[model samples]
Target: MLFGKKKDKVHFNPGNRDDGSHEQEIDKDYVEEEVNKIEEDDVEVVLNNEENIDKKFSGNNTLSKYVELGRIMISMLKDVKNGNYKNIPWFTIATIVMALLYVLNPMDIVPDFIPGLGYIDDVAVLTMGVGWIESDLHRYLDWRMENDMGI
Candidate 1:
């Protein structure tokens, strides 16, 4: 009661077979939802907040890297939405949008207001996300340069 509501626990058995074979359970907290449930207004709010978050970190040398990554992702989001780029899968866009929302979200694993440590988690999330879609992002960048869209 002191720490707040407990998170719902979810489990997965990666090695489990359809025939009900023995397997190890992976225990992790899970959040259930669909992207369609996220409102357009929330997306816009996250987009707008990006600028403020950037300004907050601009003065910090280390946090600047995280801020720049956020900018690049936002730019890609814009290009994708404007139809300036194509061949990108919907799930990729969804994942990027979700990451954007996560970075801008104030209530995360660590609160964003805590001077030095707050953004570590944000950066980690962004880093993992970038790693996850690095190939897609590279393809986008190559396409942008080839088509003169980067200019």
Candidate 2:
């Protein structure tokens, strides 16, 4: 909550460039434009919001969707941590943060080891977390596009 209050005025590093390319191997500019964006703002910018939750859970809560999404989210985290999924910088940042939380907090909605049952809650929450991260990344990507950056 404290971070939320000061998000509008806080900006993190603005010129740190990474060595990454997109799937097409295109050299994404990926420059830090420092548009008055803050650390907390960047975090939210990389994540999806409540609206996405409604959409993702709109029609029906299928088990398979959860399984597939969970796998993808997990894979994304692994890639980010391993330096493979390097294109989505903001997304990677969010994923890494969420993974840290998941590891530190033991009281998640679902137990971490009840086979398929335990996975239900974990997948849902993690999927949402990744979505938020993705949203934040999109915000930055849009900024990049508008500025004609390669990102």
Candidate 3:
């Protein structure tokens, strides 16, 4: 009982079923529940750990492709925090936060210590989050360009 309350472990199934058996995809309901729990402090934690997250992406071949998207999400969150961007929906912000949190967590669905396929779940979560907020992300990109905000 030294570490306060125990955090609930949530698993994200990467759906890597090469066999003929059906596998459940990443649980959207679980993700939504986590997103709903996002608070200002959570946003700050992600923003503060941005460099660490970037290092993880840069060091991994599979996660490298998502570095740009991760940066964009962080940028969007920064803008939202600064009150410079008001066009984004709360859902988009929450989703971005949730994805970043997942990426930052090394002991997630797939532990980051595993070689070869450690970051697969992280990639899956990032891809899923981007898909959900693609339009809002695009709009944010456009706004950034129009307002001379560097990516």
Candidate 4:
């Protein structure tokens, strides 16, 4: 409706002609609808691939580091969720969740099923996340040490 009156049908030119009289006029609504449809489909694909990445990669040579990162991520999330890690910003929690989600996603920067290189992207993303909240993670670690909350 933002485009004012609607035409019953509109013709689209494949390309610009030399005369330039028949220039393409794309409907904004049509473009927007197509983009939204594509995005929705992509989200569905991502959701379908969300599963346990650890189980798939647990036996991998490079999995130890990822498993440790997973433990740290889980601990951080639990602390935040249980109110043990108070005053944390919502964006921090969101970032952690996004990293975890990426790890769980089978199709990411590099597909997780690839032999010998599947977890490279996962490590990169998780490491970036660890760096992003370095100070917060340190604070939580210190708190745990002070409170004697081992494990």
Q: Count clashes in each candidate, considering only residues at least 3 apart in sequence or on different chains.
A: 0, 12, 0, 0
Kindly list the per-residue Cα lDDT of model 2 for residues 1-151, writing each as its tens digit.
Answer: 4121222332233144333412113111221122222244433423333234223323345645643443344444344445544555443454434433432234655564555554444444454444435564455455546656441
Supply the global lDDT for candidate 3: 0.77
lDDT of 4 by residue, 44-75 (tens): 33334433544654677657777766666567
lDDT of each: 0.57, 0.40, 0.77, 0.54
Evaluate residue 126 in candidate 2 and report its C-alpha lDDT on the 0 to 100 scale.
52
Worst 10 residues of 2 by lDDT: 23-32
How does candidate 3 fare on TM-score?
0.81
lDDT of 4 at 32: 29
- lDDT over C-alpha atoms for residue 64 of model 2: 52
Better of 2 and 4 by lDDT: 4
Model 1 score (lDDT): 0.57
TM-score (all chains, Cα) for each model: 0.66, 0.32, 0.81, 0.61
Tens digits of per-residue lDDT for model 1 on 43-133?
Answer: 4565677677567557679777767767776777677656676666554555466567767677787798887877766665565556546
**Predictions ranked by TM-score, top down?**
3, 1, 4, 2
In model 4, which runs have C-alpha deviations exceeding 4 angstroms? 1-57
Q: Comparing 1 and 2 by TM-score, which wins?
A: 1
